[model samples]
Target: MFFFMAKKDRDYFLSFIAIVFLILHLHVSANEEADRIISLPGQPKVAFQQFSGYVTVNEVAGRALFYWLTEAVQQPSSKPLVVWLNGGPGCSSVAYGASEEIGPFRISKTTSGLYLNKFSWNKLANLLFLETPAGVGFSYSNRSSDLFDTGDIRTAKDSLQFLIRWLDRFPRYKNREVYLTGESYAGHYVPQLARQIVNYNANTNHKINFKGFMVGNAVTDNYYDNLGTVNYWWSHAMISDKTYKQLMSTCDFQRQKESNECESLYYYAMDQEFGNIDQYNIYAPPCNNSDGSSATRHNMRLPHRPHSAVQLYSGYDPCTEKYAEIYYNRPDVQKALHANISGHIPYKWTACSETLNRNWNDTDSSILPIYRELIAAGLRIWVFSGDVDAVVPVTATRYSLAQLKLDTTISWYPWYVKKQVGGWTEVYKGLTFATVRGAGHEVPVFKPRAAFQLFSSFLQGKPLPKS
Candidate 1:
């Protein structure tokens, strides 16, 4: 089947191929341009470029995941790309991660304005906040069943698809060094997504530059998490000794099904014993009404209670998520961010989807196996905990990491920030573990300076400051 072609004919064929590539390049550039954000509603002027849009992951299901990318403020081209997810199994990264924790802006009280976050993570790397699982925040699937059909596997698969298509839309970042980070239940999402990216890289010729991943106050192993959580409550004096002993005996962490006794005892610990304090931050005040009942809780769900949207405190708005809900639902805000253009959404925007949370199908009992795989692959991994968070406290993280049986590379020591003890750290052979002093479940929201320092250290592949 071999035939010799004339030089002129070969030259023409090569030129035709080059032209096709050029046309495709232009089309991708146009798509990127369409997603560029000139400015958000009530946003202050900033130097970095921003883009927010949706990348369809499944055409048959009409599923698309929403993303908001904030490039590094200085030397944007040289910085690595960091994908930040917030874990509720059904939470919106845009509302929690972007607006409240690490993204560039904080929603103002009026919910119609924005203010800069001095400790935004974008200062060091490009931050991409994603709303995943097709029903969180602005992401959606036309097939209603898709909303109900979500779990670790589908979420990881859809997120991997989103990254592949997103890289095409912004080709410059296709080969950029990337890191995955998140908090709360994202302990599952971050590791699962990282595993997906690793698998994708193994099979594809074009590999993603995924260096490593880090998680804070993560839910690792069910048995360890439950054990450590009970211990933390008792040790912190949040629960009575009587309740702690009952939890240890009644709750079967190994079983997927919970007995009525365990369920009631768990509720008793949170409601009757723990008082009206913020479980996410034990020392911080709850988002409360005038009647002194709690209005909202983060990540963790409690018994149904009624409360108004009124803020009882002066500073550090605990109702920040409320502001995000108002801001993102505005017509002008959606138009500015290029969201909800199709008018396909039949319901109002919410920070977390209650239906999806209730119906989530499968969850791995432990992610320690995935951790071992990534560590063996020589990818940098880190786990951190906020000491004050009762929901998933430092004790829980320590218990989970212990199951890995990793050899300790560095003895435990206090890490410093600005001449103060920021946290304690221990470097394992394959992973690093650290704690933020007096910080809560949302580390950055409570201890931004220390969180920023820890982030900078992670990106640089260096240990936290020893002095």
Candidate 2:
């Protein structure tokens, strides 16, 4: 062991080691910042970083899910990850959740620009909006059959895969506390995905650190949803007494198929109940140019251009959806957002794909059982409703929660935001129920400040402010 090393040779070895370490560090930094959005058309100046791209979930089918992520306003590294999904069972989360709802900006009325939402949920957490299940929005599958072959089970599985692959791409968020949140038919989506995450953690040591899930104006049970909808319509005087009576006497919501007599009465009742109004928010004025067509077009469909646009109460514009469509479909905007690069999709992007909606294959009768299981598993579950939403009204959610029969931890009480009564809230042993006053089915789009308040509380696992 008496070898003498030359000084130049030793120095050369040390320098090589330093260069190698520096290159490795740079590589990690580059990967961390991959897919960063340098700028977007009509976007205002902001300090937080934004990202958008696709994560392939299935290779054989060339299936991918698209996501738009906004880091927290200040210290993004310390914030939790919150993923938002919009439910039509076929709607676009990027269109609704990112553009029109709680995302950082709202599409401007002019259809050529955007404006910052002062109450964006990204202020509190890293917000991720996903266009899921391979057929909605910019997400697509190479196998054409994959478009129509989707349901709760397939959706959950693919979403889980998306999360896994997405984290691989941006590993910084791999260990962060994750919250799965959605609304409407996401009543089915959020719970199912959480269950899958739980199973995933149990089998492998790879934990996603899933904290909980929250849904607003969700569809938990068809029977209660239908019953409560009729009751809400009748109580609110949206339907005639005879129509309400007929709906109650003839319809059996629990059954998969209804009798001919029931269908006739149901259709008649719906005709009177909806008419030319926006069923999403019963009291809110209908979009002027909208013909108020079928349930698929009015209640579940994404906003699109009509012959003309109308103004709603306050600064809210009913034509925002049209603006969103115009803004996103721009060739330059797609390049900026890094969308449609793979050519898996054949046509231009739309807010909600009619093809996807028509092809959607699964409709579960109830997601209530999943709720019971998740609550028993000690997951933080919060379900909020926009009181004015006739489609999935507060009454409907109330009836569905009643089926759970969880012991009440806090009695019903008013919750406040900015010194005003925001809504009502109740706490159960493992779940919480809340309502957003004057909000619609898409609560954030109608009452953003209140929705932000609700969302901040949910992420912090804190009760809504009671005053």
Best by TM-score: 1
Encode model 2's per-residue lDDT on 136-174: one tens digit a residue.
Answer: 888988899887778788899999999987887777898
Q: If scored against the real structure, what TM-score would every candidate get?
A: 0.94, 0.91
lDDT of 1: 0.86
Model 1: lowest-lDDT 10 consecutive positions: 302-311
* lDDT tens digits, residue span 309-339, model 1: 2122235788887788899999999999989
Query: Each candidate's lDDT (Cα)?
Result: 0.86, 0.81
Best by lDDT: 1
Task: Look at candidate 2 and tell me the lDDT of residue 413.
Answer: 97
Q: What is the lDDT of residue 429 in candidate 1?
A: 95
